[model samples]
Target: MSCLKLNNLACGYPQHGTKNSELLVVNQLNLTLNDGEIACLLGPSGCGKTTVLRAIAGFHGLNAGEIWLSDHKLADVNSAVPPERRRIGMVFQDYALFPHLSVKDNVTFGLHKLSKSEQNSICHEMLSLVKLEHLGDRFPHELSGGQQQRVALARALAAKPSLLLLDEPFSNLDVDLRRTLALEVRNILKQQNITAIMVTHDQEEAFAFADVIGVMNDGKLHQWDTPYNLYHQPNSRFVASFIGQGVFLSGRINKQHIETELGHVACDVSSSVSENIVSENTETHVDVLVRPDDIIHDQNSTVTGEVCGKIFAGTSTLYTLKLPSGTELLANFPSHLDYSLGQEIPLSANFQHLISYAKETA
Candidate 1:
């Protein structure tokens, strides 16, 4: 059985108090998590990611559908098992460790069901799992932000809950610390074979931590897929624009390729599952998603554009190119090859296939 299953899940708060109309935050969303799998819900703020997390944790009652954990039906409109009784653990954004409690005590809080010796053993194991065995005596306030986050994780895992939920657990840390702690936490969770679902707006963290990612927008799941597929084959243009940086050049679907002002390019047009512009009439408008890496600096190619802007990255520099049509495109060039603004440079497409979508209108 799957560790967690959500079916046709719909939830919303009453507009004020009356039920005449509910402001729906989660709508007809279905998700399934297998045993020991780590999934992440990624989206911008106010996209119903947190609403789904709260619903799964039993904080908000569902307006429709059901939530199941393995064989147990934890929630439905008729009833909701209290969050405490669901054997589900949560690591809050603030690292909600009790101020007065020592790390050992904090880790032991949820292990009350076990014997004293058993609780101590589990707490010690959890501490070791989080690499905090040396700081068990310290209180939450005594530890650094990273340490405090580790303690919160240890406490959550101490009880060995059936599932773990992390709600932006690294949001409070700095950028470097966020990535370090996120990778460390992923290691710890995997070592324990814990099934977890994390909510985050940070793409880097989600990519580093999750085995599967569900990209959501406006309460709807756009795609539930691997990180690779989400990057390489985004289900919607929203995902393409949101997940990474790219420029879409307007073009038309031709006989066997896409005709554009830059040049004629050939790729799998069938990849555009949403847009079928390749009928008997090949004059359909489409936009090609040209990622920075897809473009390369080539002196031999006839195609060229003026350098609009540049950013110095350690290993490579990002160059912004403006086409003759005044469309902006980006390409990453070697840091050693410096190019100045307003200088026209030759370029070529480096990718084997191109991604396109039906052109958006003003």
Candidate 2:
């Protein structure tokens, strides 16, 4: 049985002094989560990632469709479960720790229904799970940002909720700490076999922490897929642009090849590019997505491009190369071979497969 399922889930916020006026924030959202799987809703601000989280957590009643936990219906148009009754745990971005409570007390807050001894037992187990057993007695203010986050996670888990919802949980931490703590938290959730859904705009964090990721764009889900697929086989141009470092170059598709200024890519580009690739004159124009790694600095190749710009990125250098036709492309070459600006260097594309999009209508 699926641990969580959203079927055509839609929601909107009501405008003041109006019965039918609502600004829709989520539209026809559908996704499924299996037991113990970690999923993430990833997108930019105002894209409804957090809105979906809140709706799933029972903070908002869906204007359409249903939410099911396994075989049980948790929410719908005519029926809705209260937040506390939904058995969903949430860890907020701010940690939301009670200043007056110690770490131990905060962890046990949700266990109030249980007996004192049982609460203490659960609290200790949660603290151990978060690897903060020694700091259980300290107040939230005394703990570091990461430690406080751990405490918040422990408290959420102590309720033994059916699923956990994390809303930008690591955004408060520094870059290095965010990476480290995201990995650690993922391990903890996996070890406990906790089914979880997180909301984050950081692509790197989503790749590191989630088993599957749903890419969102303005109030809609573009794709719900593995990180590898989102990066390599994006369903839409929006996803390709949002997920990675890429620059789109214009190309013409003829039979089995896409002819770009860089070179000819011998592959069936239709399936990866867009729907209905055929049109008049036996040719279709497409915008090809080329990553930095796709184009390489090749000393032996005859094709040469002028070095227009460069960024020294530690292990690898990012170069902006301009073709003879004045089209610019990005390439990642080894840092050791740094070419001066305005120098012409031989470059080659090792394209395994081509990805392109249909030309947008004017």
Candidate 3:
């Protein structure tokens, strides 16, 4: 069952120094989340991902369209439910816990309507769920950053919200800690069957935490898909560039294959070329998307590139190679097989799936 749905939702803010003028931050956006599913809105800064989150949380009003939580209507062009009235919870980036309050008190803050006994019971349950049962009596200042975040999550979940909104909740933590906490929060949400939508600029975090990811650009949703599909099968040039590390290589589409500087590679039946351009009588010029994993470092291959740059990444080394035509490509090679700058290295393409776009003219 779909737990949340946004239909043609448009949102914006007032333009500075202008009267009755608005600047749209989210335009004609549509998305859906299944029951207990976790989704993330991902994009670069100032891409309106946060605006969409605010809109869904009833912080911003819509210019058009509707917001629905199951069968209940939350907002539309003419009407909106107040934020407090909506059964939605928010987890902020700063872990907005009261410094004076103990962890147990923070989690129980939203259960004011319940009896004292109920609040304490729910608080204990939430603290246990977040694995912070031992720290219930400690104040926010006494806990580590990760522990504080867990407390914020516990507080949000204590209300038993129909939907949870996380606004870059892990951004303030260190990289390693962010990843670890993201996994922990994901587990907690999954165990409790919570439907959530998080807004973030980090693709790695999105990939790790979300069951589905929506990539936004310029107030528009470029793609909404699974992490694997977003990486292996992007829907647009921007999505292809934004989701992962890759470079576009010039190529010519010839029936079921694309001929590139690397070689003549067979296109998967699901490739855009096979689906959209195969019927054309003339060969089509295109820019083929090549990921680092698609490039195999081979010693006995005729194709070779000049190693221009390399970054050692513990288990693997990322090499930036310049072809004879001056086109730069990235290849991930094992750390043990060290290659120096200006060294000529043999390479071959081993694409699991092919993706290409029409050649863009200058």
Give the range where candidate 2 is weakest over 10 consecutive residues by summed lDDT. Answer: 268-277
Cα error, candidate 3, residue 53 (Å):
0.9
* Model 1 per-residue lDDT tens digits across residues 1-362: 58999999999988987768899989999999999999999998988999999999989999999999988999998999999999999999999899999999999997777899998898889888888999999888889999999999999988779999999999999999999999999988898899999999999999999999999999999899999888888878898888878988888877667777678887666765255546756577798888899998888988898998999998999999998889889998899989999999998786554778888989
TM-score of each: 0.96, 0.95, 0.96
| Whole-model Cα lDDT of every candidate shown, in order | 0.89, 0.90, 0.91
Question: Which ranking of candidates, highest TM-score first?
Answer: 3, 1, 2
Residue 151, candidate 3: C-alpha displacement in angstroms: 0.4
What TM-score would candidate 2 get against the native?
A: 0.95
Off by over 4 Å in 2: 16-19, 279-281
Candidate 2 lDDT over residue span 182-205, tens digit each: 999999999999999999999999
Ranking by lDDT: 3, 2, 1
User: Which of the numbered candidates is closest to the native, going by highest lDDT?
Assistant: 3
Of the pair 1 and 3, which is ahead by lDDT? 3
Candidate 3 deviant stretches above 4 angstroms: 268-270, 274-279
